[model samples]
Target: MNKKTVKSFRPISWPTKGASAKTGKWRTMRPVIDKEKCIACRICYIYCPEATITPEIEIDYEYCKGCGVCAHECPKKAISMENEVH
Candidate 1:
């Protein structure tokens, strides 16, 4: 039988304890979308690092970290970062 050499450390099993935490709880600001101004280009959804922005332009605050990547990358200037009320 031929033997193969291992190249790098690739862990198979991973822990998911804190991986699904709702990061939006600590957000100082949140992205608010203006439906009227939005062009539905999906730029925000593409730029969102957390994958929180949906294709329909709806923001999933549950996992949103409020990094503002979506707002900054929006070409139509439809997404805005506002102070979180709570």
Candidate 2:
């Protein structure tokens, strides 16, 4: 019988800035979270491709591309997409 060693999982360390640029600058729409309605489920944080949303539900607009994934995945409908003003 052969025994295999199981490897523990480790998360990747993401860089502060993407290779392209600060993606937020190109965003046409931004996600707005209604804190009053938010339950802090971390759904948006898990689904965000940019990983711009924190576990505390705070969004880092500097890196966020405003893809609307957070708004779409929000079960409570607390996140809404609005046109980015400047």
Score each candidate by Cα lDDT: 0.82, 0.86
lDDT of 1 by residue, 1-86 (tens): 22234334744333553365678797889999999999999988888888888898898887788899988998888888999976
Candidate 2 per-residue C-alpha lDDT over 1-86 given as tens digits, one digit per residue, 9 for 90 to 100: 22233333634333446756778887889999999999999999999998889999999998888899999999999999999987
**Pairs of residues clashing in candidate 2:** none
Instruction: Provide the RMSD of all predictions against the true structure, rounded to 1 decimal.
Output: 6.2, 8.7
Clashes of each: 0, 0
Global fold similarity of model 2 (TM-score) = 0.78
Q: How high is each candidate's TM-score?
A: 0.76, 0.78
Checking candidate 1 for backbone clashes, the offending pairs are: none
> Model 1: residues >4 Å from true position, as ranges?
1-18
Off by over 4 Å in 2: 1-16
